[model samples]
Target chain A: MKKKIICAVLIAAVILLSCCAILIQYFVGGKERIAYIYSDDKLVKTIDLNSVEQSYSFVITNSNGGSNTVEVRRGKIGVTQATCPDEICEKTGFIDSPLVPIVCLPNNLVIKISSSENENIIPDTVTR
Target chain B: MINKKIVSSIFGIILIIVLSSCNSQSVDNRAKESETDIFAMDTYMSLKAYGENSEKVLQKTSDKIKDLDEMLSVINEKSEIFKLNNANGEQIKISSDTALLINRSIEINKDTNGAFDITLYPITKEWGFTTGNYKVPTQARIDELLKYVGSENIILDNDNNLVSLNNHANIDLGGIAKGYAGRCAADIIKSEGITSAILNMGGNVQTIGAKPDGNNWKIGIQDPNDSSDIVGIVEVADKAVITSGGYERYFEDENGNIYRHIIDPKTGYPAETDIISVTVIGSDGMTCDALSTSLFVMGIEKSVEYIGTKHDYDVIIVSSDNKIYITSGIAEKFTVSSKFSEYTLNTI
Candidate 1:
């Protein structure tokens, strides 16, 4: 009876761990996190895949003397945010997907997203 | 025996359900990864439009645009109109590219009076806004350049194909040149098979086609008060959108007074108006860029009246209240979301 109980608990533990890992991979790995570029997280830029249209260009700057001009259309690329005024490195609009990063120049802020094919895999700690 | 079997089955089913749910989630996430192409440093102006073969095309196009910039710099140095070296009145021959831009400048100058003067270089230097060097100039110095800054003073002889500036005034196309380059790139891209692209030259933006899914290309207009908050999103399917804001370049005095770059030709001072930024969306990028600057200097009321006469283009103006004024047609196309809730979209 003791041996059976131990086996049951061990099996349940393995099942739970695997389930948690799968869950993390789905939620964290599949979709790129939308960057809420803000001065104080007040939702400065909503850079989610759903929100961005192909071939869109805009200038994003922060108060930190950083400014960047970003252009995204079909191909992904982010560049040219360094200007004399506010160099919000957000000028590099070149991220093709969520895996890449878009920066803000003046603010010295970096919002990173995933782009690699295996980006859907979640780590063990994060699965919880 | 029956009770033991029932308990075993129930536990097994529960475990399977939990396990399946997690497995499906992982599958769903991996399934949606979008495939995209990347164009790096090869992303010069005209090359962005060539689609798959854009890497090679971009290389060629960037070289061409850089060459154009160099040519214009040379023109700035030797043009008899600017006369950087000579104060004496002498007719100097210019390169064809410089002449073309000058001719275009002359037309805009003639049509808009001194409102769209390219010959404001001397005054621009006096204000110290051109090279990121900021300092308040004396009233006496501004007044001196103001006399020679009028676009009307520029003479364009179509017969001999020559151009001249009165009183040795200078011209600067920095405000309009990027837009022209964007338009040229758009034209080049359209010539190729690729139909969809966006030309984002600094604050000037132009769209070539709808999305790959054939939806309207949404371009967000930046809030003048807060660079992070979008004032509104403009739906530009096949058009150019350009914005000119008082916030782009400016400085604050000890008294906290703001001095901006967009100078009004009439007053020779930074345009002081309630409107914070002007975004013009039209068919041509260069036209949109020029008109946006012109309208910013013209102020809101007059600019709205001017826009009313044109049926094809649309505009959005952000005011001091953070209220957004847009054309009726544009209002119909955009969906007001939680982000723009604070902004009032007033249709002109």
Candidate 2:
């Protein structure tokens, strides 16, 4: 009887341990590593940080004559320069989460990140 | 007795393994999120659908929003609004979407007692808000344009899908079009079997359902003073959260006074109010969109009074005095962020 109770308790503890592991994985395992660049609200470029071997930079100019310079390094992306008055986008630095977006209101530019798992899920249109 | 205990123990072990595995596996499956970003309605629009058909649903929903953009854009020369604007007081045939938006605008105009009006295009144009010139219109110029700044002057015939202006009033649906598009996008996402989705037209957000994990979707309310800072977080499910603030679109004048894009129909100038921003949360995106603007114009005391008369919405008002007021309905779900910890939080 004592052996049976010990066995049951061991099984329960193992199950509980595995449950905690699963919870941790679900909450912290996936990180979005791809970034997208938008000019005037249009998706103009996409960068895959996981595959990036070296740092690179590019400039995007909107129809309204505003411009933003974007930089991408290993595992990170940011706006290095912009002609907008606020300079908020440049100060935002590098970001890698789908939740945080670097936006330049004067240039109508935005840089957003998405996980590789969500790369194909394109939203139809943005209304702002 | 030992045999019975062993049998039950094995059964319990099997059940534990099965149940825990199911929980983790189901969560993993539901975490599949499909998102798309497009430019429409003068802002970056993002749609995210979480479910089996997320990719296809997002594509279809994006197409729907783009179609609406093409049909409703005032600057798009071939759009219904463009044709109607250029009609010179003549009845112009419009698309069903354009007619519906006009009807909704008119309804909101009456509901807000003329606080929300789409007929302020002439005034806005003169102020260079649309042209990006950022000029202050003379008082004489504003008074002349104010004559055409009433939604009552526009007529919509739903049956024939026609629209007409009584006094050459040009309508600019910038105030409410984004919200209308968000509602339509949410509808498309739901109809496509996307049980969970978020439609963010700039800051105006509409959720189709709760997060797949059964937790409420947490939305951060942007601080009116700082673009990067969020003042609070709102937890909601299947609701629309729309924010209107003077800080969103504005220009600084020669002497350093700020002019917001939201022109007051009554004054023919940028809305002058102590309230910095107004956020409306409701099931209807369009109403929340219009109410955000209307409430911003109404200021704090009148907005609280206006909300008291309504049952379907809650509000978060941030005044220039640094006080944040949340309606009782949303007070429990709202959490003041550290950015606004210094500010007072009042429940109305």
Candidate 3:
């Protein structure tokens, strides 16, 4: 009698967990925040904003010379330091939205959020 | 026995639902796309066009940019523009590129009441805006250059591709060059069988057509007051959107006086106007680019009054007091950012 009760309860819990997962996947699968970093027009890195668990920093250097220091938080990315003369990329601050991209002209680097593959996504923006 | 059978059947039905739902999530297949980043014309340009011929279009654009930079650079000693500026009253045989740009600039200058003067290059150079070692020029020096700051002083024999300048005037195509480049890139893309693309040159964005899915591209105009926030979004197709704002580049003196890069041709100083930024949208990228700067100098009220009823293009002007004046032509196309609800919007 005890074994049968335990079996039924286990079956119910498994079914409930599966339902919860499908619901979560349906909501989460459509809107994805992805950032692509390009140097001299070549893509160097891609970050999934939703999955980032901790803050970190990285550096991108152009072979022709010049570098940019990128700092990443859970949902945003920014340039903290740069070898570019104006440091305009650093001044642009952190960007969470796909609309505005961070560009370091001197270093020949660009960081922009990707919305092309996000089918359910709307409102793609090009910032001035 | 009956209770156990019911529970087993329910469990089996739930498993099938889960498996079917997981399988039903579609993986979309999109059209081919080619995108590349290029640094040219003193800014980073991202060119992305869809279709199989897009790669060829990008290569052609890259080559054309190199040629354009060589021909139009005022700072490059060997550039055609430099040679003409130092021409010293002699008619230098110029390329069609120089003739076309100079002709358009003259027309814009007349139309904008000298607000779009190409001859303001000397004054701009004196302030070091081009080299970025920026400083405020003395009033006396500015006044000296002001005499040479008129497009009328430019002599162009359009029949023959020859150009000259009078009164020691110098011209720089920096303001309109990027837009023209974008326009050329667009033409190239279309010629190469790519229907949709964006030649985004820094603050200047020129689009080719609607996306493959038949949706207009959404462009965000950066807030002049706050660099990180967007003022609004504009939906566009086959249009060029260019923005000019004093806040984009400026220098501050020790006394906390700020001097901007856009030197007013009349005053020979950074434009002092009620307008903080001007964004122009039109089919012709060059016109939109020149108009953005010209309108900014015209101030919020004058711009509205100047562009009233013409409707050839649209403008979104943000004033110093944080009010937004959008042209009625693009009123439906623009949606202000919710964060900007604090400010009032007046559709012109």
Which candidate leads the pack in lDDT?
Answer: 3
Give the residue spans of candidate 2 off by over 4 A.
A1-58, A62-66, A69-100, A103-108, A113-128, B1-27
- For A12-83, candidate 1 gives per-residue lDDT tens digits of 776677677777866666545344333322345655543456657676565654555555443344555556
Model 1, B248-308: lDDT tens digits are: 4676668788788888877778877777888887886666766777778877888888889
- For model 3, residues B43-64, the per-residue Cα lDDT tens digits are 8777778887788778898889
* Alpha carbon deviation, residue A83, candidate 1 (Å): 12
Which sections of candidate 3 miss by over 4 Å? A1-19, A26-70, A81-85, A113-122, B1-29
- What DockQ does predicted model 2 obtain? 0.18
lDDT of candidate 1?
Answer: 0.59
User: Top model by TM-score, which number?
Assistant: 3
Badly placed stretches (over 4 Å) of model 1 are A1-27, A30-128, B1-47, B74-89, B95-97, B110-113
DockQ of 3: 0.34
Judged by DockQ cut-offs, the docking class of candidate 3 is acceptable
- TM-scores for every candidate against the unseen true structure: 0.66, 0.78, 0.85
For candidate 2, what is the TM-score? 0.78
Q: Which 10 successive residues of model 1 chain B have the least lDDT summed?
A: B31-40
